[model samples]
Target: MDLGIAGLRVVVTAGASGIGLEIARAFAKEGARVVVCDVDAPALDALDSGLAGHVCDVSDRAAVDRFMHAALADLGGLDVLVNNAGIAGPTGRVDQIAPEDWDRTLAVDITGHFNVTRLAVPALKASANPSIIGLSSAAGRFGFPLRSPYAASKWAVVGFIKSLAMELGEFGIRANAILPGAVDGPRIRSVFEHKARERNQSVEEVQAQVLATTSLKRLIPPQHLATVAVFLASPLGASISGQAISVDGDTQMLV
Candidate 1:
């Protein structure tokens, strides 16, 4: 399926690695001109030549400003913005989590979306088929035990994306959120490790418990999310807005 996004201008946050990297690569595969920003300089340097990369921490407004300027210049304009940057946050009881950790999570997960979108909107407004895709999580829809900070920030992401859909609809810029559950990656492994340590259990036990909540009992691939994002940004998904689409194989809970 040609998503009909060839030559589309796009920017993806934290696109140097993990899910974000897959998104950038997917867009590039569909022939979209892609620019990605990440805080890790080494990762940025290692990105595929097809995808331009820059160093920027989305939590820092100044850094986002610089990245957006550079990225838009490279793309000549913007048609899509993929807000995929986020952190696992601290895994522990609400009382056990530190105030700083909570603040940081919100800053990057929610505020970071605001930071990038505000800058990308003007460019997006000029496009004929503009769209915004935010990477929310299953935790956003369900309460996650021992992951209060992550859950709170992800939930905020849904609200943010829904509000953006309403606010930007007049400009033909659609906005939606993708809620993935337990994506297969080092990040999820680390999250499992943290949860296991917190619950005095092994990583395998925690991983199994998490998968058990899903009907398919499996971890989601980053490419699956990339496919949904590309479709949403294409003309084929013009009517899809204000939606919290789940790519998680029928996940029932966050475990």
Candidate 2:
């Protein structure tokens, strides 16, 4: 199905690895002119998808603005902006969480999105079908007990997208957030390990408990979320805005 995304100019933050990398590949596969940014210089250099890559730290406003100018010039204009940069944040009880850790999490997860979106809006407005896709988490919907910082940041993403959708709707710019649950990756494995240590359970036990919350009883592939992101950037998702779409396998809760 022609998703109608071909030739579109796209930029994805933190797109050198993990879910962001997969999303960048998806857009490139659909013939979009993709530009990706990451703090990992080696990963950016090694990206084999034939898309543009830049070293960018999304949490830094000046760095984000620099990336925006370069990316927009490379692609000539922008049709989509994928806000996928974030950290797992410190895993600990509220009292145990360090002040610096909380600040860092919010900096990357929430302010990072702001840094990118505000700069990309002007270019997005130039496109006939513009989109802003945020990578939120299931924790945004279901509060995570031991992951207060992560949950708070993700919930802020949802709120950000909603407000953006309303503000940009008249300009034909669609804004949406995707909520992923238990995606299979090193990142998630690390999260499970942290949860296990926090709960005083084995890693296997933590994994089992997490899977039990999903009706599918399996980890979601990063490609699944990538596919949805591409769809949202396509004409097929023309009217999908201000919505938090879950790509989880019917996850019941975060606990």
Question: Candidates' TM-scores?
Answer: 0.98, 0.98
On the 0 to 100 scale, the lDDT of residue 213 in model 1 is 92
What does each candidate score in C-alpha RMSD? 0.9, 1.0
Q: What clash pairs does model 1 have? A: none
Give candidate 2's TM-score.
Answer: 0.98
Tens digits of per-residue lDDT for model 1 on 15-52? 99999999999999999999999999999989999999
Residue-level lDDT tens digits of model 2 in 92-157: 789999999999999999999999999999989899999999999999899898789999999999
Worst 10 residues of 1 by lDDT: 190-199
Q: Which stretches of candidate 1 lie over 4 Å from their true place?
A: none
Candidate 2 lDDT score at position 109: 99
